[model samples]
Target: MAKNNRTLLLIIFLLGIFIGALDTGIVSPARTVIASQLSISSSSSVWIVTIYTLAYAVSMPIAGKFSDRYGKKKVFTLSIALFGIGSLLCGVSNYAGSFSFLLAARVIQALGGGGIMPVATAYIGESFPIEKRGSALGLVGAIYGVSTTLGPTVGSALLNLVGNSNWGVLFLINVPICIGVIITALIVKDEGIVKEPKKMDVLGSIIVTLLILALMYALTNLQFHDFKNSIASTKVWPYLLAFIILLPIFIIVERKSLDPILNLKYFTNREIALTLLISFITGAGMMGIVFVPQFGENALKLKTGSGGYLVTLMAIFSGISAPLGGRLVDKYSPKLVLSMGFASTLIGSSTLAFIVAKNPSFISLLIGLAFIGLGMGFCMGTPLNYLMQTNVDPSETASAQSTLSLIRSIGVAISPNILIGFISEAGKNISPKLMTILPKVTIPGSNTAVSMTQGGSSSISPDQLAALQNADVTTITDVLKQFSGSMIDKFSPMLKQQLQNSKLPKGVTADTLVAQWKSDYLAQIDAIRSSIENMFQSTLNEGFAKLFIGAAAIALLGLIFTLLLSRKTKPVSSN
Candidate 1:
C-alpha cells in the first residue's frame, strides 16, 4: 500500500467512526420532545434510539466479513450511502405524523450506521502499518470520544435551533456530510488486496443476526423494564430461550461454512478471544457510566440539565484518556495501560457509590464522572493493538477489529436490559410502600429526582369535592395522587375525633390505634425511599467500582496473555 493511499483510507476510516459515534448518543435528549410531537408514548419513541444500537450491534460483524469478499471501498461507500439515506428519510417522514414510518426510517439509518463502524475500524487496522496500529486505533477512539461527549449537548442545542419539534432536522443534517464522505470514498481505491475465491456465508449471517436480535431484545427488557406495565414481565423469556436455541446452531454453521459472518476459528486465537472479551466488558462499563446522570438525580436531586452533565463529564475524560492510553500501548505493553484504565473506572465507580444525599456542584460530579471516561479511554484502545499482535494474516485484520467492535457492542446491546434488571432487582427490595408515602418522588427521568406531586393543598368547602370530581384529565392524576396522599395524612385525626364521639372500644379505641398505624406507615414509607436509594446506590457504586477494577485486571490479564503471543510471536508480514 502506498503512503498517501494509507493516509487517505485513515481519514475516511476516522470519519466513519466519528459519524457513527455522533449518531449513537445524539438521540438521547430530544427523544422525549420527539415522542409528544408525534403523539406517541416515550416507550415507542425509545426505538428511535434503540434501533440504531441494535442495527449497529447486529450488523457490525457481518459488515466486517463482507469487506473481505467485496472490496473494502465498495462496502464502505455503500454503508455511508445507506446511513445518509436513513438520515434523509428522517427529515421527510416528519410531515406525515407517522411514528411507524419514522421508526422504519430509523431502521434504515441504523442499517447504514451499523455497517459503517466495523468497516471503518477494519480499514484502520488493515491500512495502518503494524507498528503504528495502536496509535491509528487510538486516533479513531479519540474521535469517537469527542463525538460521544458532544452528542447530547450538541443534539439538544441543535433541537433548539430547529424548534424542538424539528427533531428530524438532526437526521437530515447528516446527508450532506455523508455525501461528502461517499464522494471521497469513491475516489479512494481498495487497500486490502486478496484472492477473490472466498464465498459469502449466507446462512451463518442469518443465524448470527437472529441470535443477536434475540439477545438484544432479552437484555433490553431486563435493563429498561416498564414498572407500570406487566407486559414487561413476560417479554424476556422467549428471546432468551430463542437465543439459547440459536447460538449453538450459529456456532455450528460458522464452524462448518466455507465463509462465515463471523469466523469461529478466530475465537480460538488467544488474543482474539481476549480482545472480544475486553470489548464486551468495556461495553458494559460504558453503559454504567451513561447512568451516572441518574445517580446525580436519585441521590442528589439535582435539576434536569445539571444531572445530564454527569455523562458529559465522563465523555470528556474518556475522550482525553483514550489517546493517552493508546500511546501507552505503543510505548509500553498493552497490559499495563489497559489495567490502569480499568483501575480508574473502578475508583470512580466506588466514589459514586458512597454518595448518600446532598446537593453538590455539577462540576464536582463532572470531575468524578471524568474518571469513568478516563478508565474507558484507557481500555478501548487495547483490542486494536491486541488484534494486530495476534492475527497472522493482514487480511484477517478486518475480521478481528470488526469482531471486537461487535462484541463491544454487546455491552450496549444489553445495556437497557442490564440497567433495567438492576433497577428491577433494586425495586423489589425497595418497598413500593415508600413510593406511596414519601413526601414526593422523582418521576422516571434524569439524575435529579423531582416531586411527582405537589405539596400544596386547596382550601375549599365540602361542595368543591363534587365539582373537582369531573375535572379535566390533565389534573386528574395530580389531584388524585395528591388528594389521596393528603387524605391519608388527615384521615386518622378526623376518624379518631369521630370515634371519640361514638365511644369506641372502651379503653382500647380502634381510632387511636389506627392513628398510630398511620404514623408507623409514614415512618416506614420514608424509610423505604431512603433505603431504596441507599441500597441501589451502594450496589451500583460497588458494582461499578468492581467493574472498573476488573477492567484494570482484564488489562493485566491481557498483558499476561500478550506474553503468550510473544512466546509464539507471529512475524509482522511485510507490506
Candidate 2:
C-alpha cells in the first residue's frame, strides 16, 4: 500500500474509534432526559448505558477474532455499517417513545462499537512500520481519552442546544460520521486475506460469550453506594458465581479447540502475562479519573456539572502525554516508557489521596490529575499496545489486542465496586459521629443547659433528631441546616416559658433578658452549625481520601509490574 493510502486509512480508522468511544459515555448526561421523555424510572433508564456496555464488552473478543479470521478492512467497514444502522434505530426508538426498543438499539450499537478499537488497533499494528507503530497507537490513546472525557460535556451541550425533546439527535448524529468513515474505508485498498484462515471457533465463542455475559451482568448490578450488601444480593452473586463456573469451562473448551477465540498459549509467555497484568492494574487506575467529578462534589464541594471541567483538564493532559509517550517509546523502549508512566501515576494518585483529598484545593487537584493523566496517556495507549503487538504472532494481532482490551475492561468494571466501598464505608459513620458532637443549647439569664442528645427539654424535635441520626454524607449538610432552624423555632417557645416561670437576674428586666437571650442563642447556633458542617465535610474528605488511596495502590502495583518487563522489547518484523 502507498504511504498516502495508509495515512488516509489511519485517519479513517481513528475516526471510527473516536465515534465508538464517544457513544460509550456520551449517553450519560442525557440519560435523565431520555428516561423522563420515555416515562421510565431513572434506575430503569440506566439500562440504556448498561446494555450498551454489556454488549460492547461481550462482543470485543468475537469482533477481534472475526477480524483476524476475515480481513481487517472487510470487518472494519461492516462494523461501521452495523453501528450506523444501530444509531439510526436508536434515534427512531426515541421518537417512537419505546424504552425497550431503545435498549435493543443500543445493544446493536455496542456490538458494532466493540469491534472498532481492537480491530483498528490491530490494523495499525500490522500495517504501520514498527518504528511508527508507537506514535500511531499513541494517537489512538489520545483520541480515545479526548472523546471519553468530552462525551458527557458534549452530550450536555447538545441537549441544551437542541432541547430535551430533541434528545434523539445524539444518536442520529453518528449516522453521517459512520457513513463517511465507511465510504472512505471501502475506498482504501484491501489488506490481503490470511493465507489459511482458521475455522471459526464456534464452541469457544459461545462459552466466552456466556462467561463474559455472566460476569458483566453481575458487575453491572452492584450498587456502589451499598457495596457490601449489594454484592451479597441475588442481583450480584448468582451471576458472579455463574461466571466463576463458566470461566474454567471456557478456558478448558478454548484449550481443546483447534482455533480458540482467545489463544490460551499466549498466557504461557511471562512477558505477555505481565503486560496483561499491568494493563489490568492500569485499567483499575483509570477508573480514578471516572470518579474525579464525584471526588470534586464530595471533597471540594464543587457543583455537579463543574466536575466535567475537572475531567476535561485531565483529558487535556492525557492527550498531550499520549503522543509524547509514543515518541519516547520510539526513541527508547516501551519498558522505559511504561515505567515512566506508572511512576507518574503513583505520584498523581498519592497526591490525590494525601494532599488534594485533605486540602480540597483546585490547584492540588489539578496537580494530582495532571500526573495521573500523564500516567494514563503512557500506560493506556501506545506502549502497552506496542508491547502486546510485538509479543503476539502477527496473524493474531486483532485477537491479542482484543484480549488486552477485554481484560482492561474487566479491571475497569471491578475497580468501582471495591474503590467506592471505601467512600460508602466512610459515609456510614457520619450519623454516629454526628450524634456524639450534637450541640448543647444554653438558655439566657439562666444556668440551665439542654443537650440535643437528651430526650426531655431538648431543642431538636423528634423528627429532626431522627433525621440527624439517619443522615449520610450527602444529606448531612442539609439535615444539619434544617435541624438548626427547627432548634431555633422550638427554643423560642421554651425561652418564653422559662422566662415566665422564673425570676430574671437581679436588676435585669424581662425585656432586657429576652433580648440578651436571643443574642446569645444566635451566637451559639452559629458556632454549632459551623462545627457540624466541618465534621460532616471532614468525614466526606476521609471517604474520598480512601478512594484515592485505593487508586494509588493500583498505580503502585502497575509501577511495580513494569519492573518485571525486560528493559528492551524484541521487535516484531514489519515484513
Candidate 3:
C-alpha cells in the first residue's frame, strides 16, 4: 500500500474516533438539562450514557467479526452511516419529546460507534509495518484523547450558545462529522487481504448481547431500588440471574463453536487475560470523565459551561502523553511504559480523591486532572502494544481488540452505576447526621416557659421566663455540644459581630438586652440548621468526593496488573 493512502486512511480513522469521542464527552455536561427536559430524575437520565456503553460493548465483537468476514471498507462505512442515522433519530426524538425514542436512538448510535474503533484499529494493525504500528496506534490513541478532552468543552460551549433547552444539538453535531468520515473512508483504497466466508457466530452474539444487557440493567437498578428487601421488586434479581446462568452457557458455546464471537483461547494467554483485566479496571477508573463535570458544577460550584474545563485538563494531558508513551513502548519495554502509566493514573486519582475529600480548590483539582490525563494517555497506548504484540493473530486482530474493548466498556459501564450507588447511600447516611444536629428549642411565649417563670414579677409570664431560661441554657448547651470546639470558636466571633450590629430598643435594661441576645442567638442557630438541611448540594459534594476515592482505589488495583505483565511476551507477527 502507498504511504499516501495509509495516511488518508489514518486521517479517516481519527475522524471516526473523534465523532465517537465527541458524542461521549458532549453528553456529560448536558445531562442535568436533558433530565429536566425529559421530566426524569438525574439518576434515571444516566441511562442516556449507560445504554450507549452497554450497546457499544455488545456490538464491538459483532462488528469486528463482520469486518473480518466481509471487508473493512464495507463495515467501516456502514458503521459511520448507522451512527449518522442514529444521530438523526436522536435529534428527532428530542423534537418529539420522547425519552423512549431518545434511548432507542442512543442504542442505534452505539451499534455504529462500537464498530468504528476496533475496525479502525485492526486496519492500522494490519496495514502498518510492525516497526510503525505502535506509533500508528499511538496517534489513534492521541486523537481519541483529544476528542474526549474537547468533547465536554465543545458540548458545554454549544449548550451555552444554543441554550440547554436545545440539548439535541449535541447529538445533531455528529451528523456532519459522520458524513465527512463516510466520504473520507470512501477515498481510502481497501488493500488488506480478504478472508473466506465463515459461519457467523449469531447464537454467541445474541447470548453475549443478552448477557451484557441483563448485567448492566441489574447494576443500574441498584441506584433506584434496594437489592436486599425484595429481589424481584424491580427486575434486578431476574436480570442478575439471567446474567449468571448465561455466563457458563456462553462460554461453552463459544469454546465449541467454529467461529466464536470471542475466542476463548485468547484468555489462555496470561498476558492477554491480564491486559484485559487491567483495561476493565482502568475503564472503571476512567469514570472520572463522566462524573467530574457534575462534581464541578455541584461541588466546586463552577458555572454550567465551565464544569467540563477540569476534564479538559485531563484530556489535554492525556493527548500530550499518548504519542510520547507510544514512543516509549517502541524504544523500551511495554511493561515498563505500562507500569509507569498506571503509576501516573494512581497518582492522579489519589490527588483528586485527596482534593475532593478535603478542601477542593479549582487549581488543585486541575493539577489532579492533569496527572490523570497524562496517566490515561500512557495507559491507553501501552496496553494496545501489549495486547497486539502478545496475544492477537493478524487476521483476527479486530476480533481480539473488540473483545478487549467489550470488557473495558463493561467496566466503564459498571463504574458510574456503582459509584452513583455509593454517592446516594452516602447522602442517605449524612442526611440523618445533619438532622441529629438540628436545633431543639422552646421560646419564651411557649407553654413550656410558663412553669419556670412563675416567681417573676415582670410583665413577662412566669412560664415564659422559664421557657426563655430553658432555651437560653439547655437548648444552647445541646447545640453547642454538637459542634466541635473549633467550630464554636469560629461561630463565636461571627455571632458577636452580628450582635454588635443589632439595634436595641431605647432605655432597655441590661437584663432585657441579654434576653434579646439569647433570642437572636437561638434564631441564628435555627437558621443555620435550616440552611444545612435545605442544601442538598452539600450532600452531593460529599458523595462525589467519596466516589473519587473509590475510583482511585480501583486504579491502584489496576496498577498491580500492569506490574504482572509477562516479561517474555513478544509481538505476534502478521505473516
Candidate 4:
C-alpha cells in the first residue's frame, strides 16, 4: 500500500470508531425524555442501552473471525452498510411509536458497531510495523475517547437545536457518516492474507451468545426487585442457572473446536488474561461517563442541554492525553504507563465522588471529569492494547482484540444496571426517612381536636406503622386516605359549630360551610403533596451521591489490577 492510501485508511478507520463510540453514549442524556415519549418506566427504557451493548458484546468475536476469514475490506464495508441501515431503522422506529421496535433497531445498530472497533484495531495492528503501531493505535484510541466524551454533549446539543421532540435526530445523524465510511472503506485495498478457510465455531458462538444474554438480562432486570428479593427470587434464578450451565460448556466446546470463536489458549498468557480482566473492570468504572448527564440534570438541577458541557471537557482532555499516553508507552514500559493511567482514574473518581456528596459546582465537576478523561486517554490508548498484542501471535491479533472488546462491552453493559439498582434501592431506603420528616402542621384552631401522629391514628400499632412505612405506593396512599377520613371526622363537628355561631344573612346554609371546609382540606392536601415531591427529589440526590462514591471505589479496585501488570515485560519493536 502507498503512504497516502495508508493515511486514508487510518482516517477511515478513525471515522468508523468515532461513530460506534458516539452511538454508545448519545442516548444517555435524553434517556428520560425518550422514556416519557414511549410511555415506559425509566428502568425499562434503559434496555435501549442494555440491548445495544448486549448485541455488541455478542457480535464482536464473531465479526473478528469474519474479518479474518473474509478479509478486512469486505467485513469493514458490510459493517458500515449495516450501521447505516440500522440508523435508518432507528429513525423509523421513533415515528412508529413502538418501544420494542426501537430496541430491535438498537440491536441492529450494535451488531454493526460491534465489528468496527475490534476489526479496525486489528487492521491497524497488522498494517503498521511494530515500532509505529503504538502511535497509530494511540490516534485511533484518541478518536474513540473523543467520540465517547462528545456523545452526550452532541446528543444534548442536537436535542436542543432540533427541539427535544425530535430526539431521533441523534441516531439519524449517523446515517450520512456511515455512508461516507462505507465509500472510503470500499476504495481502500484489502491487505489481509488469504488462507484455506477454516470452519467457523458455530456452536461455540451460540452458547457464548446465549450465556452473555442470560447474564446481562438477569443483572439488568435486578433493578425491578428489591435487593434482597433480587437475590432470592425465581425471577432472576432461571437466567442465573442458564449462565452457570453454559460457562463450562462454552469452555469445553472452545477447547475441542479446531477453529474456536474465542481461543482458550489466550488464557495461558498471564499478561493477556490479566489485561482482559482489567479491561472489564475499567469498562465498568467508565459508567460515570454515561451517568454524569443524568446526575447533572437530576441532582445538580442543570438544564438538559447544559449537562453535556462537562462531558465535552472530559472528552477534550482525553483526546489531548491519548497521543501523549501512546508516546509514553513508546518511551517507557506499558506497565508503567498503565499504572499512571489507573492512578489518574482513581484520583478523578475520588474527586468527583467527594464533590457529588458534598456540593457539586460546575468548575469542580469539570476538573474531575478532565482527570477522568486524562485517565481514559492513557489507560485505553496503547498500554493495555500493547500488552495484549505483545502476548499473542501475529495471527491471533484479531481474535485477541475481539475478546478484549467483548469483555469490555460486558462490563459497560452491566455497570449502569448494577449502579441503577443500587440507586433504586437507596431511594427506597430513604422513603421511610422522608416519611419521618413530614412536617407537623397546626390545624389552625383549638376547637379542632385532630392531631397529626406518626401512624396517623392512635389505634394503629407500632407494627402497623412499620408496615405502612415499608408499604408500596398504593398501600401508603390507602393509609393516607384513612388518616384524612379521621381528620375529617374530628373537624366536621367543630366546623358546624363555628358555622352555627356565625350570624349569617338569609339563604346561607350549613352546606356552604362544608364546601369551604372541603376546599381548605384540598389545599392542605396539595401542600402536603408538594412537600412529599420535594422530599423525594432530595432523597434521589442523596442516592446519586452514594452511586458516585461506589463508582469511585470500583475505579480504585481497577487501579489495583492495573498495578499488577508485569513490570519485567519490555516493549517489542519491529527490527
Which model scores highest in lDDT? Answer: 2
What local distance difference test score does each model get?
0.64, 0.81, 0.72, 0.73
Assess the local accuracy of residue 89 in candidate 2 as a C-alpha lDDT between 0 and 100. 97
TM-score of predicted model 3?
0.79
Per residue, candidate 3 scores C-alpha lDDT tens digits across 525-574 of 55674355334445666677677778778877877887787764566543
The total number of steric clashes, by the backbone 3 Å criterion, in model 4 comes to 0
TM-score per prediction, in order, is 0.75, 0.86, 0.79, 0.82
> Model 1: what TM-score?
0.75
- TM-score, cand. 2: 0.86
Clashing pairs in 1: 219-417, 222-417, 222-421, 223-416, 223-417, 223-420, 297-447, 297-448, 318-373, 342-552
lDDT of 1: 0.64
Model 4: runs farther than 4 Å from truth?
31-44, 193-196, 223-225, 233-235, 294-305, 359-363, 429-439, 447-545, 568-575
Ranking by TM-score: 2, 4, 3, 1
Task: Give the poorly placed runs of model 1, Cα more than 4 Å off.
Answer: 1-5, 223-234, 298-301, 355-367, 382-392, 421-575
Task: Give per-residue CA lDDT, model 1, range 80-173, as digits (tens).
Answer: 8988998888888777788888888888888877777666766675565656666767887778877876787678778878887688887788
| Model 4 agreement with the true structure over 1-575: per-residue lDDT tens digits | 88888888888888898898888878877888888888999878878887887788778888888877777767777888888888888888777878999988988888998888888887776787767667777887798889888877777778889987788888899999888888887787766643346887899989988988888777656543356777566757788899999999999998888788887876766777888888888778777677666566554554435566777778888898888887777677777777777778777777766775356666776777778888888877577777777776666666678988888766776687677865666556654654464444334333443334543446555665555554332234335544544555556677668767877558876657565655565556555764554454456667677677777777777778877778755433211
| Residue pairs with backbone atoms closer than 3 Å in model 4 (clashes) | none
The best candidate in terms of TM-score: 2
